[model samples]
Target chain A: MPTINVTLYGDIAQYGSGKQLATLDLDLPQDANIGLLLERIRLPSEERGYLFVNSVLHDVPGLNASHNDPLKDGDHVGIFSISHMWPYQYRQGIHLSDTLKAALEEKGVMKNTYRE
Target chain B: MARKILRIKMDDLSYKYEEVPSKWAKWGGRGLTSNIVAEEVDPTCHPLGPNNKLVIAPGWVSGTPAAPSSGRTSFGGKSPLTGGIKESNSGGTSSQKIAKLGLAAIILEGMPKDSKWYVLVITKDGVKFEEANDLLGKGMYEVDEILWKKYPNKPAIIGIGMVGEKKLSNAGISVNDPENKPGRYAGRGGLGAVMGARGVKAIVVDDTGGPGVEIANMDLFKTGRKKLTDAITSHDLTKPGGGLNSYGTNVLMNIINEAGGLPTRNFSAGYFEGASKISGEMIAETVEKRGGGMTGHGCHTGCIIKCSNIYPDEDGNDLVSPVEYETAMSLGSNCGIDDLDYIAKMTYQCDDLGLDTIEAGNTIAVYMDSGALEFGDKEGALSLFDEIRQMTPLGRILGQGVKATAEAFGVFRVPTIKGQSMPAYEPRAIKGIGVTYATTPMGADHTAGYTIAPEIAGVGGKVDPLSDEGKSELSLTFQAATAFIDSTGYCLFIAFPILDIPEGWAGMAESVAGVTGQSITGDDVISIGKEILKVERDFNTRAGFTAADDRPPEFMRYEKLPPHNEVWTVSDKALDEVFAWVNS
Candidate 1:
């Protein structure tokens, strides 16, 4: 088993420590991925707005590409509620995970919002 | 009822109306102001001298009901702070009123021979100047209250405070919001000092019974308006209860901190531990608990995206209308202060004193780095406002802005480009914005080109924020696009939806076409934006700006910011390429 540091923000924090912002450490199986971590915390994938793995963007609401990427030990993950936004202008040239980068390239143009 | 220009000769205390010249008929807002300043004012004249002129204009669709968030007003002049051409715009009722009154622009020129301060009252009939002896030395809040009582019609008032009267380099022009709060501001580039130099304290615009804006093509306007309204209402980041409407612009505090680009502690660190305390989420939560405070507040009428908020004190009294993200970062995290209440008070004081919040906060931070005041000294920070009011020598030095304060105190780690302080973002961590700060003629303005959309949010396209590759092109593209948006009278927040939604961008062009009765396309809009940049850059060149002027401070290249621990690595060749197209 490995432990991962997770931080949740906005409305989604209720799924973790029941506060607006909460940081918790969770123990998971050896081959655990982001999907497993989400399931363990009972946070649905649909409710997440932005996801960052060690400050590298991995998921946006409309585009989720890192769900199956294996999580390493001591990894830090940040989850944001859909109500939270990071405009592109402010983050231009920010680092992106390979998974999200590939997905964005395949999709060609970036879309604004993602809804069920 | 045709649109006309109102020229006020402050030296003679007289005014005249002139028909819109054929060449300038198509220009509005920043486009018109920059063009007027470039054509009429001498480039080498002292920014606050008699030879300098202040030009004010609204966007083409400013007064029309069909254009949402299209009531922004632009003020243009040679900047005393940057010593370059500058256009600073703000959202308020004045733009719509000026447009409705059938005025294309207002030009204030010449220095008054008399020492008496005057207030200009503009109505449908003409302009009248009255001595403002009683309003002298008063903060903008008291001045707004007095003027509202004097004018029963509740006209839009644009005024300055003691800082402007003293002609401080950081002084900004204050515009009254819908609530009659003098918080809305064209608060950049020290334009208020120019207005002050002309011996004018305020300008009141009353549009009662005035001929409204003439729409050349009503059907096209309506079509474009509907498309844009649909895009705005549907966007998750802008609609009601969306990110902006729910928490306001201060929402960036947490995310930027998480991304290791928050510019904490005078740009020495990138992450601020106290970011969440003064974030948009905390602000909204406090506003909900406090009865008198409100979220989703509008700065002006006809704005669909109400990202503004009214923060309340502990006793349920209104403290400040909005505590913007830039202010929170510059005054809060960057200065090592985490108390939200204190930041709000500082914001209100800055607004009332007619000082540019970004410049004022950065100056204080530089002063702190100079060992005058310890970081996060709330009481000492608050007392500086009184020092400024009392006209202390030390206060005057701080009021001159970051570069001056740094030079005065012998602080070598100054964060400025072209004599203006950098905004909230750390250039060492975000290389693209560094490119923008170095290359923009406006001198380190975030709004000059916001590449954060693609770099952080993945809106238009994704880019690696840490990489220096392609940043020059990214900055060039954004700077041109932003220049166009600044001229539309529409709020820059619209960039979010328009960039993501193709129809929204088209609607913007169509709306302008409908107003001016000239067909336009997306390419034409970008071309106009580039043209505006060219005119501004040319003026700066004539004012003695060189390639050396277009760069970040040397400290940024040597000193690495924390968390990411990155220094500015963008090549100088790439920076010069940003404006190389202008000469081409």
Candidate 2:
């Protein structure tokens, strides 16, 4: 078995302690699927809303983790609990391009951005 | 009232009859009017011009014995708010009573000469226009009082206040309730300005204790009414009269604030620390404690959910009209005044003077940010409305719109989309609402495509509020469904439960079928809504407004709201998809 370090950003941090960052260590068989991670910690979000590492709505059924696609190390993850938080989780890719990031950094808003 | 429209051209005050379209029979009430306006009215024309037609419709289940279904009506036009299309519905005896008079949509055209005020009276007897000046420049409440004394024994009245009298951009049309009070307003969109420009001061419809609506199949209507009313009474949103009925819209202050997207002090921040003091709970307590009125007032007859109320000052004086979540957030939070009483006074001033809450709120936000008025300053804010009434330079720019205000003050982040002002929700946060504000043809309206039903009320499949993927599709679906529901003239609040039961819309439509001597279905309902969208779309295209006007402010994508620290990440390219219905 190999242990993988998983980091949570955006709403997932708020779910645990309202922080902007969190990390969890999970032990699984080699090349485990991404679904196994959410199954390990079923978010107790009473809001009945969720976000995936890839910023999807996490609409998968059941907690079974082996069915999903495999994940690699250093991949960014996010979880959202509020029903309206869906737009924010998926936007890290749209405006966070390298050039855009540089521009945002120059503008000073790129600081405190969620990162691993 | 079935299969009819009281098509009145104001040019010579002449009238004609038009048979109700088959698609419209299922989508009764405001829903019908909105559809007609969208299809026929040119969006780019002057909202007060003859090119703009008003569609006044009763609900599919309206003009019946269904509790809370009898007293509603919707007014549709190309809005002065967002410079798009609008169908603002209100509750009063007018819709129910007018439908009883067998008039469907009241299409008014040709601007009347100045110094003239006309009243359109619809009764079982006939439709006639009577010059109305005894009611000119009167407050809404006062207008209702005079009309009530003139026509007793159940007559409905709709009027324009002083704001409309001036044809200000932030005017609203008012209607009287069962109590003969002009508390009900065709509130948003500055349609009242359109009415004011026509020199129409008040409308009186006397049922005269006359026979009510011509019920086609009474048995079917009764059965459907029982079920629909029960559903309304049973739902948590409508139960305990739900949030809207219990505390009116004030319930939203805490809800939006807790979400941390209330847009305090002109979008400077999201949270208002003094929110609880101006909350619905506080209003309820204050009214009950001070021997003042606090309970919600029904906008129309047969409404199980009474989401309207007339809030009074501490001395038991009517300070303003009923203040809601949007008004509170706009004037209270957005303007940074946490005082409920002050908010109530401001609310009363707008209603009595006939101003749109969204515009007033937007004006306050602009003033606070420009240092013309300090944040949380109630006195200064109240004086601003007075200045607008006086037609000051600041008032003129503020009256034109939020965009105008920003330009006059030279502020970058004006928080307006199109030419219209943004409501309570802060863009760059509240992603679902931001999507709604961005794409709705009505322009930055929270009510145009209310995502709160799903986002906050836990209504259907969970659509991620923050995600932009599939959001265009999501907003399109919601706005379409909403357009259908709105055309029906049924209260949009009923949507809380209607979303759960697929049959709910059909059942309501079935009652409409029984009344109209026509048959309709849920599928027909969607088509009608789609057709309505196309109509509004074509109107805009004719008026030279392109797809470019649909996106939110540029700052929305960059500025991250606090607490959430999120900006609107959705791309304009994605936003263009929401309007794909235009091409289709």
The DockQ assigned to candidate 1 is: 0.44
Show where candidate 2 strays beyond 4 Å. Answer: A1-116, B16-27, B38-44, B67-70, B113-115, B209-211, B316-318, B450-468, B501-506, B517-525
The most accurate candidate by lDDT is 1
Per-residue lDDT of B1-584 in model 1, one digit per residue for the tens? 67899999999999999999988888889989999999998999999999999899998889998588887999999999999999999988899999999988999999889888999999988888999978989999999999998886899999998899999889999999998999888989999999999999999999998899988999898888887888788888888888899888987888878778887777888888888889887887787777778889999989998999888999989999888899998888888889999989999999999888888888888888989999889778878888888779988887889998899999998888888898877877667788898989989898898432342222234443334457777787788788887888988888888766778878888888888887776657666888999999999999999999998998888887777677888788999999998877
Using Cα atoms, each model's DockQ against the true complex is 0.44, 0.03
lDDT of 2: 0.64
| RMSD (Å) of each candidate, 1 decimal | 2.5, 9.6
CAPRI grade, predicted model 2: incorrect
Taking chain B only, the TM-score of every model is 0.97, 0.91
- Candidate 1 runs further than 4 Å off: A1-3, A17-19, A29-32, A68-75, A110-116, B451-468
